[model samples]
Target: MSSSNSVEGSYSKRCAACKHLRRRCAEDCVLAPYFPATHPERFECVHKIFGAGNVARMLKAIPVQERAQAADSLSAEAYWRVQDPVYGSTGIVIQTNQEISSTQCELAKIRAQISMYEAQMATEQQPPPPGLPQQQGSLGSQENMPMFEPNDPFNFLN
Candidate 1:
């Protein structure tokens, strides 16, 4: 009917949820703003993972102000589910945490090695103990003794 067509034309062509559900999108559809028709796949993925009924129930159960955020979370979860069927986003998070821990351990080892090298260098540059004199020659050698003339006039014993 012309009136029906006009009424339908008055609203958006189709919201993502309506397209995924294969139904007409009403003007006041709650999901229209969050899931526009331009990105139907967003709703499709979410619907496939969390059934349409569950999504509707969840949206209805939460506060109206929080629905958009919830829809975003659902879409992200669905995408992760498709990417990693076994572990999803959780696996990626775990793997990232493990890498961070490993890097931290490696950094600690490098710091300890640097400290050891610094200690070794410091010891090498330090002067020896004060009281230990350097050995130049034997103590009993007469080569360094002062020579005395036997006929010196200044000799008091003569």
Candidate 2:
């Protein structure tokens, strides 16, 4: 029916940005693809952090093919800015870097432990020196174990 067609036509014509701006969304509107009418909050957040004019100018400045990625980046930055007014995304980056470093250090330590165990096993399997008499129950005793320094620095790259 004509009524249903008109409703669909009206709904598809306005994007979130244009609707928020109280203007019609032209067919060539750059913001339309990124900010559809269904998710007005995305456009609102981006608008609040980076003004509508700035967003429009930035989108226009970039290549059309890269606009979607730019929009996502802008939205994420806006979200971070809202969550952390002072540091924003920088705080998140620093925290993530610290966590990665901690995990790398832990992995290095475990690898070192595994290496030590393998060395011990290899030594245990080898026959004693030709002239030396083997002591009973002393082959794998704790007293003869080599001391491993807990404070040894382990480089993940090495």
Candidate 3:
């Protein structure tokens, strides 16, 4: 029964590239796991943008641990290429830079406004000039009185 089961065991389906190429998928095929048959469109886009040979070469050039990341990058690049044939990812980068510049300009404007407000507050909080006499009494008799010292705790008049 085990022998029969082993004999009847199904072989894993070929990856997108192998299926598209009508070639046998080896056990250690590099593109198999990344380009599974479930997401054929992803592989199709990647394959269309970067040819199968180029994809295989890229995957082979990178270390095994980095292959998945490389595949993801390739897929994103392929998608962007389909969206913008002329500029692709460069268009995205440019748009992002413009957004950053706009945000920085807004931030600078806000900072300048804040600085102006702070300056106004500082001026508002300052004491009037010494030469400018404030009203001391209704009859103006106390106008000529000596300035009170806030730091003197003992009242000499008392």
Candidate 4:
């Protein structure tokens, strides 16, 4: 099991505990039947923990001083932390986020598609969000289209 190639290649296998837990999304991992589809990236499984950056984000959500204090208590305590139910439900896992890595990959693909869509939008003048009626003559129709700011790091085209 301890092979150099294991760390290098696109290994899709996950741990049994994660697989058996049957989670809906990694964010709801605190509860039974966890999944990894909560984040915009949907790469929760790829993270190989819970949600994409959920651990980091959860940790970050707390104040640094509180985290340090909790860390100390955690080390001193012989018992595990109190169990809190995951925000997600068991049905959620069954309905979606079934396969950890595959689901995660699918979620990634969805995000990529969304990003592509957003990028495509960035090329054109802003349009009404989908489902909304387009103005008879919107800015995109104007001839004097302002040049996009390339210097701006968020040019989006980049």
Q: Residues 46-130, candidate 1, lDDT per residue (tens digit)? A: 8888887788788888999999899899899988888898898898899999999999999999999999999999999999889
lDDT (0 to 1) per candidate: 0.85, 0.90, 0.86, 0.44
lDDT per residue as tens, model 4, 1-158: 55857643322233222444333223333321222223212232323334334444544576765755443332222121112134324444544665776889999999999999999989786755899876556555555666688798767897
lDDT for residue 38 in candidate 2, whole number 0-100: 93
Q: Model 3 Cα displacement at 124 (Å)? A: 2.0
Model 1's lDDT to the true fold?
0.85
- Against the true structure, candidate 4 reaches a TM-score of 0.19
| TM-score between model 3 and native | 0.66
Best-matching candidate per lDDT: 2
lDDT of 3 by residue, 1-158 (tens): 98766534423377887777777777789999799877888888898899999999999999999999999999999999988999999999999999999999999999999999999999999999899887656667765777767667675753
C-alpha RMSD of candidate 3: 12.8
Worst 10 residues of 1 by lDDT: 133-142
Per-candidate TM equals 0.72, 0.67, 0.66, 0.19
Task: Give the range of the ten consecutive residues with the poorest summed lDDT in model 3.
Answer: 4-13
User: Whole-model lDDT, candidate 4?
Assistant: 0.44
Q: Which residue ranges in model 3 land beyond 4 Å of their true spot?
A: 1-12, 20-24, 61-65, 133-158
Q: Candidate 2, residue 26: CA error in Å? A: 3.8
lDDT-best of 2 and 4: 2
Which model is ahead, 3 or 4, in terms of TM-score? 3
Task: Report the Cα lDDT for candidate 3.
Answer: 0.86
